[model samples]
Target: MALMITDECINCDVCEPECPNDAISQGAEIYVIDPNKCTECVGHYDTPQCVEVCPVDCIPKDPDHAETQDQLRAKYEKLVAAKG
Candidate 1:
């Protein structure tokens, strides 16, 4: 599943740099995760780096954008291809 940054986010700014996909960005209030670019680090790492470094524990799977591991890998591949 794609991860989301909840309202509970403290905006300490650690999560943005941790995203391998460059999906996390500054919102009006808190950092936001772009679901289209989120793969939960499936093709990049064993665990989502943002979630791993998040001090507030505000990152969670987005039920609204649920995806399986295979789906995430496919997304990651697509993203990588697009970059090249």
Candidate 2:
């Protein structure tokens, strides 16, 4: 499943650089995760890096964009291919 940055985010700016997929970005207020680009580090690491580094623990799975591990891996592969 894709992860989301909640309103509880303190905008510490730690999560953005930690995202391997480049899915996190500054929004009007807090950071936002682009579900289309989010693979939760499926291809890069065992755990989502952004969640690991976030100080507030505000990042959580986005139920609205629920996806299986296979789907996330597929998305990660697609993203990698697109970068080439």
Candidate 3:
């Protein structure tokens, strides 16, 4: 599943650079995660890098963008291909 930064986010700017897929970005009030780009670090790491670095523990699985491991891997592959 894709992760989301909630209202609890502190705007610390730590999670943005940690996302391998470049999903996290600054919103009007807080950081936001692009579900289309988020893979929960499936293809990049064992754990979600944003979740790992967030001091507020605001990053959580996005219920609206629920996806399985295979789906995440496919997204990761697509993102990589787009980058090249």
Candidate 4:
């Protein structure tokens, strides 16, 4: 599933750089995760880096954007290809 930044986010800016997919962004108050770009770090890391680094544990799975591991891998490949 794609990860989401909840209202509990502290906006400490720690999670943004930790995201391999560049999915996290600073919002008006808290950081936000772009579900389209988030793969839960599937192809880049064994675990979600943002979730691992978030001090408040605000990063959680987005039920609305849930996907299988294979789906996440495909999304990652597409993102990589688009950047090339």
Top model number, lDDT: 1
**TM per model?**
0.98, 0.98, 0.97, 0.97
CA displacement after TM-score superposition, residue 8 of candidate 2 (Å):
0.5
All-Cα superposition RMSD per candidate? 0.5, 0.5, 0.5, 0.6
lDDT of 2 at 20: 85
CA lDDT of 8 in candidate 3? 97
* Higher-lDDT candidate of 1 and 2: 1
What lDDT does candidate 3 reach at residue 36? 91
Model 1, residue 24: distance off in Å is 0.1
Instruction: Name the 10 consecutive residues with the lowest summed lDDT in model 2.
Output: 13-22
- Report residue 25 deviation for candidate 2 (angstroms): 0.4
lDDT of 2: 0.94
lDDT of 1 at 51: 90
lDDT of 3 by residue, 1-84 (tens): 899999999999999999999888899999999999999999899999999999989998999999999999999999999999
Candidate 3 segments whose C-alpha is farther than 4 A from its true place: none
Off by over 4 Å in 2: none
Winner of 1 and 4 under TM-score:
1
